[model samples]
Target: MKQSTLSEVKSAVTPRATLLVIGVVALQLLFVVSYVGALHEPKLRDVAFGVVAPQASVEQTMQRLDELPGSPLDPRALPDEETARRQIGNRDIDGALVVRPDGTTDTLLVASGGGRTLSLALDSLTGDVLEAQGRTARMVDVAPASPRDFNGLSSFYLVVGLCVGAYLCASILAISAGARPANPARAATRLGTMVLVALAGGLGGAVIVGPVLGALPGSVWALWGMGALLIFAVGAATLAFQGLFGVIGIGLAILLIVIAGNPSAGGAFPAPMLPPFWEAIGPALPPGAGTWAARSISYFHGNAMASSLLVLSAWAVAGVVITMLAAVLRQRRAADAGSSAAEAGATEPPA
Candidate 1:
C-alpha cells in the first residue's frame, strides 16, 4: 500500500529518533553560546598586578591604579623590583611596574610566556596610566615565549589534542566491545587498555610539539608524563559515563569535554580575561586544569601547579571507581535473574 509523504516521514522518524535529534540540537546550541560568550569580549578583569615604588609613593600608586575604570588591574605594593620579578616568575602576579626613585621612567615587567594576549593587555593598560602621569613606561619581558610558540598558545592546543584523543579512544573501545562492560574484569581491561593508549598518544603528542614542531620549549619528559595523565583522566571518565548510561554516555562526554570544557579552558583567552562564569568554571574542568598545568610546566617553572594536578587525579580516580561499580552491579543483576529462571524451570511440570 502506498503511503502519503507525511505518513512516510512520521514512520521514518520514531519518537526515540525525534528525541535523539532534539538532544543533538540542544548540544549544538550550547556549543555556539558557550564559545561566543566566552570569547566575544576580551576585557581584563582584576588581573593580578604589582607596584614597586618607594614607601612614601607606593600607597598613592596602588590607589590610583585600583581606581581605574572597571577595576581592571588588582594592584599591590611590592618592596623592590626584585620581588616583582620573582613573583611574576612564580605566577603569583601577571605583570609588575617598577617605579624609579630617581627618574621619570618606570619599567614594566611582563611575562609573555604566561600568555601573550594577557601580557599585551597589561602593557596597554599600564602604558595609558603612566602616560596620564607624564612618565614613560618601559616594557621588559621577564619570561618571553619561545619564538616558535605563537601567542604562547601551544600549551593549550596540546592539552586540547590530548583531551580529544582521550575521548575518541574510549569511544572506540566501547564500540568494539560493549558500552557497558559485563563484569569487573572487563571494566579493568578497558581501563588498562586506556592507559596504554594514553601513554602512546601522550608521547607522540609531546614529541611532535616539542622536537618535531618546536612549538613549545619545555622538558620533553615532563610534558610526556603530564600528557599521559591528562589522556587517561579524560578517557577513564568517558568509560565511566558509558558504563552507566550505555550509548547515550558519548553525548554526555561531549557535553562536558567539548561544549563546556573547551571554551572555558582558557585556551583562546586566559581566565581573568574571560567572563565571570567561564573564569569560575575553567579551573574546575579537565581541559582547563590540563591547559593550566601545561602552561605552568612550559613557562612558569612548574610553580603553583599543585591544585591543577590534584583536579586531574581526582577525575581519574572517580572514573575508575564508577566504571567498576557499574559493571559489578550489572553482573549481580544478571546472576540473580539467571538463578530465578533456573528455580522456576526446576519446579514446573512438563508442558
Candidate 2:
C-alpha cells in the first residue's frame, strides 16, 4: 500500500511541475537577497556635490571632501553660490556647501525633493566636516518636497504601484487567453487591451496622488502621461516575455520588474547612496526610470528627465516589436507544418 501511494504521488507531480517549483524557490531566495543587499547598508559614495568659497579654500575644501573615508562626496568647485543653486535645481549636483567669505557660518544647500534620506546624509556629512574645522554651516532646502510628501517617498511608491498593475494585468491576459497569442492580430489585440488598462490605471493613480490625497504635487496631466507610459512599458515587456516563453514568461517578468527592479529603484535611498551594482542598474529599469521622472515633474520643473524617459521608451518599443514578431513567426511555422502534413497525406498510397 505504501509503495502504491508513493507511485501515485510521483505520477501526480510531473517533471515540468517540479522544475517550475524549483524556479519559484530560487526566485524567493533572490527576492530576499536583493532587497536586503541593496537596502541593508545605504552608505553614500561619490555623491555629486558642489563647493563654493574663496579661491584659496576651494581646492583645499574639495580635497578634504574627496579624501573623506569611503569617498562619500564627489566635490567640484562651483563659480559661486548662484551656480550651485542653479546646478541643484537642474539636478546636476545633489548638494552644495557654500562658505561665506568673511563670515564663520557656511550654508549647505540640499534638495529634499530629490531624496529626503540623501539630503539628510549630505547635511550630516558636511556638518561634521565643517565642525572639525571650527566652522559652522546652516542647511537650506533649495527645492523642497511637498509638505504632504513624507520622506519624499510618495513618488517611488506611486511608480511601484503602477509597475505592479502593469505586470498583474498582463499576467491576467496571458492566463485567460493563451500565453502565446496565435497570430499578429491576437497579439495586437492583447497590446490594445493593455493600453486601455494603462490609461485607466494611470489616471486613477494621478488623481489619487494629486487631488485626492495631495501626497504629491504635480501637474495632473504630466503625471497622467508619465504614469501611462510606465504602465505600458512594463505590461508590454511582460506580454513580450509570455509570447516567447509561454507561461514561464510570467515568471521572467516578475523576476525583472519585481525581484530585480524594486529594491534597486532608489525609493528609500537615492542612487548615490546605493551600492555600485544596484546604483548602476537602477536608472535602466522601469521602476527606477519612472520614479526619477515622477520626482522631476513634481519638484525639479521636469529638468534632467530626458535620460529616464528614453529608457522607459526603449523598453516599451522593444517589447512591442518582440511580441509582434513572435506571434507572426509562430503563425508562419504553424502554416508550414500544416502544409507539409497535407502534402504527406496526399502522397500516401490510397487505402
What are the lDDT scores of the predictions, listed in order? 0.91, 0.94
For candidate 1, what is the TM-score? 0.95
lDDT (Cα, tens digit) per residue for candidate 1, span 52-116: 99889999999999999998999998988899999998889999999997999999999988889
Best by lDDT: 2
Superposition-based RMSD of candidate 1 using all C-alpha atoms, in angstroms: 1.8
Clashing pairs in 2: none
lDDT of 1 at 152: 90
- Candidate 1: which pairs clash? none
RMSD of 2: 1.1
Give stretches of model 2 more than 4 Å off.
1-4
Worst 10 residues of 2 by lDDT: 172-181
Question: Can you write out model 2's per-residue Cα lDDT over 1-351, one digit (the tens) per residue?
Answer: 999999999999988999999999999999999899999999999999999989988999999999999999999999999999999999999999999978889999999999999999998899899999999989999999999999999999999999999999998987686778899998999899989998999999999999999988888898999999999999999999999999899899998899889989889999999999999999999999999999999999999999999999999999999999999999999999999999999999989
> Which runs of model 1 end up more than 4 angstroms from their true locations?
2-11, 344-350
